[model samples]
Target chain A: MTRGSVVAAGTGLVLGLLALGPALAPGFTLAYDMVFVPHPVFDRETFGLAGMLPRHVPSDAVVTTLAQVAPADLVQKTILLAILVIACASAAALVPSERLTARLAGGVVYAWNPFVAERLLLGQWALLLGYAALPWVVRAAARGEPRRLVLALVPAAIGGFAAMAVSGLVVLVIGLHRPRPAGRSVGVGRSGVKRLPWSLGALLVMSLPWLVPSVARFSGVPADPAGVAAFAARADTPFGALGSLLLLGGGWNAETVPPGYGAAVTAVPWLCVVLLALVAYACRGRAAGTGGLGVAALAGLVLASLGAVMPGLLRWAIGLWPGFAVLRDGQQYVAPLAVVVAVGAGLVVDRVAGRRPELAALALLVPVALLPGLAWGAGGRLAAVRYPADWSRARAVVTAEPGDVLVLPWEAYRTYAWNGGRRVLDPLPRLLPGRVILNDAVRVGTGGRRDLRMAVEDPRARALDPLVRSGAPLTGALRARGVRYVAVDAPEEFAAWAGRLPGAERVVAGPDLVLYRIPGATRSRETPISQWPIAIAWFTTFAALVWSIRLPVGSLFALSSKEP
Target chain B: MRIAVAMLAGIVLALLTSFGVVRVITTSQQDPVVKPLYNYGTR
Candidate 1:
């Protein structure tokens, strides 16, 4: 294809995606349950508790208690905004002359990036919108305009601090690739400070959050050295050891690693390696061109590439992150790769452009030409649904009574578990003024397996279902602690437990769960954040489908593409 | 002329962005954490 033809095609593709994403993401979410739904962003439990329940955060932990308001449910909203930010950033990438080629290349690479697709679809807009600022910063660096750097970084300071940190690395690599001052020395320059990208300061700010908060979170709590050792042992696989550059392209994030910083770095090559090779061949005629620059960034990116996957280094880089003491897993380091991909994209495409005739057009068209970007978006939306146990079934069973306590077990007693509105007996009861919650760890035997150790046999610590035997101590604890509701995972022994109490009465039972009220215990309603509404929604939707009632086909909903 | 054009464009973009930002804050009234997620002292 002619250079201009490719450019036009790419731009057209971006425009097309810009329009389609908003409508498609939610639709896909409804259809083939996305993988992320169960796994969730941030705290999956919080998503269920706040969004499905009373739409609020409970004053439970020091972290949640510290919030003036619950952390903003930014996912669905983030997806909606991703469209706007992508469009705006795409426009920014098509900037002034002289640097127009690099900007076009950056835009082209960004449009097709899977990591960017993740941001667009997964509701990680806080991180995505942050990457949108990269192009302007690049343009400013290309022009050596300090004012532009300041202007570009101000938004990062307010909106995308983490994106700034991860993507900032890309800007540095690109700046190094820039045509420097004619007489510039190795380190020192006109003013004496190293000539670093001004955007780097803002990026430093972004990484600070990941680093600072993590450090503070762990500083007070000493590492379970055994836990860290187990994590290290688990890193035997390529996915575990974190050696692959491609793995970094997954959008790094974890309790242990920083976010998307690595994906941005690695993704640039996936889009450009072939094109870079083509450009290197295309540049056979050029005097001094981007082929060499591409090679340098490519090589540097590859060396740093392993850093994307080998998050073990991230364990050491803990010095740079928030929790210097406690090192988490590979997931957290994805941010660096994301930033790398974003900025590296600009350079890789720039290399391709520098060597080709009318190269700008090709770079512009690159992302649009890659059909996978669309599929990537769909894949992410469907990811949110992969897990089924996202919403706490136990939480949903309770009727919204303030002081009413129900006993439910968390251990693996697979069948008929999570009967409505039942709290487990020991720990929960221990917190109450007169209630005693029967806990496997405390009253019953610890360990997920069943064994009756508490009552000469707590029925936990050995059997497949620990809570099955927990019924005895649970009933006894419910009596002694004056608990009213026994929210057990509805099973055969529940009747036997209830029978032992003189005044026990059955209060509630669902298809899977059952609740019993003890005698002389005060009556109390269930919790508001209980899973009732979700249950109702499921039942209502199922019933409607059985009768073939028309389901709402919303335009605004996001959809996933099966083809991609 | 370029300065004026940039200024006008900036203002328009700012207004549009403000509208977008407002749309976000208005609709996303939810929490991102699970409750009793960790019974730390007890566990």
Candidate 2:
């Protein structure tokens, strides 16, 4: 079968499998931070584009654009499915073989691995999008076609900065390994030098959206070491880390593991490790690209190991540059390894099929039978729900109040009856129309050393622990900080506590939500440094996106005319 | 021309399938009001 036909089939299969659970039982899967509560994306007081620029510019932009036209739940589901299809099809495209079975095997292994499943369970869709685009980035870089390079950045850009970083690494690896010119010395050669700048330039330009903001926020705060270690890939031990890399199963939170998962599943990744070793050995001198991919896979595993084998190294590195905190969740590095393993699996399947075609059908069952729980929505964690109507009523009240609002219970995750009993990021931010000050404290250390206070990163979210606990007078100190309305979605005692505070009047009291208005409070304005970066980043992103799109379209037209 | 066309076509197909999947999944169940009884801070 043709490469395109194979890719199409693979994409269809992935979408079918991914959509099966969501289709059977859908609302909005309230897993992790993927709160599907619908709210205006461009709301200046809430998710204004400017506010989201530095961290999640691309993802927020896409969601904001989609939210403008479609329901938030649909927008999320569509993006999720798109990530799966893109991941599968791109992996299939990377396989050197023309055989449909090999491509299909590669696509399945790449798109539906433990990494994707765990990330899905964790609701890190943006990271998954980046993971999905890695193979395409490698394919584009290897071809060294200008048009392919430009087009490749589109997906990488959509995946956001993390995806671009991964893609950039792949490009760098490929560029370094570019076969030295026929007669040139053993060094990187002239052609390699020329390609390096171009590839790096594309990555830089495409990543400007997040790059600008990341630079601005680089020295703003220090990351917590314990927080970083909590998210580290702690697979039992160093050997377990390697096994987890093979299984793509080193998520920091054990809750992210699908229900009913057992030790037997370890055999699937073990089988993959053996097959990959065989493929690497067989393709050593014959196929340079496969060898390079194998090397990249090994590098990914080592990186994923993080401090597991060499604890002091990662801690030392983190001390030098806190920004490396992003890499703290070493499990994410396993994404590229997954691509290599999938492709390797495909190569092994192709070899076996070449000698005995019928046996290739059995190879397909390996990944399927192993990750049975992932196929059924991470053991039903992907179930969906609707937000409560009271949220809307509270939003309306806050929208009219004209001051920054504070959500009570002062926590990040909540198990709302509105979301079918699943734990989700507090829906208050989405439910409120005005600027919100949520208590996003980073709980670090343990027992005596444990520090649970509002994150220093955003000073706007005032540490309300004292005020809430003491039921202090709301007029003098709290209102001076610009907190106009305090909305508590907790039990009656909490609402009653807030109500008794001096100058706090109960507004919109309901069974689920209670709002207390501080009449004299004012809205706090964001500082210029915080606001300017977003504006500049947005401007750069818009300009880059326009240029990237126009150049490719113009090139396509020119190529079409030349072909005829 | 073929590469660009194929890439665009694939993206369009992915988007369409996404829309279809979302529609089917969302429509399958009644949208219930989410009101959590407990505050489970970030875990």
DockQ of each: 0.02, 0.09
lDDT of 1 by residue, A348-429 (tens): 4445555662554444444433323333223222221111231234333332442244445543112222211111222222
Docking class of 1: incorrect
Chain A TM-scores, candidates in order? 0.45, 0.85
Candidate whose TM-score is highest = 2
* Residue range A1-564, candidate 2, lDDT tens digits: 344544544564554355336523555677665655675555542223222224455666677677889887788777777777777777766555555566666777777666777777767777777787677666556545444565666766776766676666677766555553452222232355566677777777777767766676556655555545556675531346666665677776555664434355455465555467346534531232422444556666777777456656777777777776666667777776777777677777667767765556455545544555565465346776665666677778777766777777656666665555556666676557656766655332222443333243444553555665575556666687777887777654464556455668778677677777887877665553455656676676567656656544322111000000
**Segments of candidate 1 deviating more than 4 angstroms:** A1-84, A87-102, A117-126, A135-216, A222-365, A368-376, A379-564, B1-43
lDDT minimum window of 10 residues, candidate 1 chain A:
A555-564
Measured with C-alpha atoms, the lDDT of residue A231 in candidate 2 is 61
Ten-residue region with minimum lDDT total, candidate 2 chain A: A555-564
Q: What is the C-alpha lDDT of each candidate?
A: 0.34, 0.59
Candidate 2 displacement at residue A367 in angstroms: 1.2
Please tell me which predicted candidate would have the highest DockQ against the true structure. Answer: 2
